[model samples]
Target: MKKCTIIGKTNVGKTLFLINFAGYLGLKFLDISLCDDKKILKKYKLSINQAIYELVNDQTHKTRCLQSIIVDVPMGKGKKKLQLIDTVGLIDGIHSNIEIRKAISHTLTIVRVSDIILHIVDAASAGRDELPSSMGEVDYQLAQFAQLKRGYAILANKMDLPDAKEGLDKIKSEFSGNLIIPISALHKKGFKEVRTFVAHNI
Candidate 1:
């Protein structure tokens, strides 16, 4: 199966997007495979609400490992299996915590081998300063690197927020040539376009 990795800076809604997107794809229960920095694997079966409550957090770096789910996207009359991988959030500088540093390293390794790259940027924080989701050097670098791949798109998440429209406009101006889909992961808006992009590439 092809792997589609979701990556973004800390607290940028990567985990929420993963869970909610899976739910949108008709998964009522989540069978998530988690891999830690030490490469130990564990599995959990969670209800949609339970996964949101336990996994999604307002705090930064809530996900200290890689969490992935196997999803089937509709292709013509059939479905195609794809691995949707939610990675530990990236940061601008070296982390002080060794565990987080290791997790970040692991995330980068996954990126190198991923078949698709879904780079999420928090539109609510994009034009702001000193926010975890604010567009930074890391996002620019990721876009540059992932552009080499045939399956790469930017999801400007959190369009439900008040300031997110402005941020989305800023993002559009900044990332002029790339495929960007403005979406609200919380509300599942603009998901069809995302699915279409994924389907076309896959």
Candidate 2:
């Protein structure tokens, strides 16, 4: 299956996007596979609401491992299966926790091998300064690296929030040559564009 990894800074709504995007694709219950820093994998079954409550969080590094789910995207006459992998949020500098650092390392490894890259940036935070998910060096570097691949696109998340428009504009200016789709993971807005991008790439 094609592996499309969701990567971004902490608290940028990557987990929420993963869960809600699955729901948007018509999944009520999700079979999620989580891989820890030690490379141990575990699977779980949960409803959409349950996964959101248990996995989504405001704090940094809430997703310490790699969590993935398989969903089929409708093509012209058939469906294509792809693995939507939600990764540990990447930070600019070294993390204080060793385990988190290991997780981040694992995330980078996954990024290198994934077939598709959905780089999410917090548009609301990008409009402001000093926020964790604000436009930073790491984002620029990731954009530079991922742009070399065929299946790379930016997801300007949190478009439903106030000031996100300004943020999206700034992101457009910064990422002039890349494809960006504005989306609100919480409200399930702009999912059609995202689906189209995924389907085309896969």
TM-score for each predicted model, relative to the true structure: 0.96, 0.97
Candidate 1 lDDT, tens digit per residue, 28-62?
99999998534549998998899999999899999
Error of 1 at 196 (Å): 0.7
Q: Tens digit of lDDT per residue, candidate 2, span 54-100?
A: 99989988998899999999998999999999999888888899989
lDDT of 2: 0.92
Model 1 error, position 162 (Å):
1.2
- Once fitted onto the true fold, the runs of candidate 2 whose alpha carbons sit more than 4 angstroms away are 36-40
Which pairs of residues collide in model 1? Answer: none
lDDT of 1 at 153: 94
The true-versus-predicted C-alpha distance at residue 153 of model 1, in Å, is: 0.4
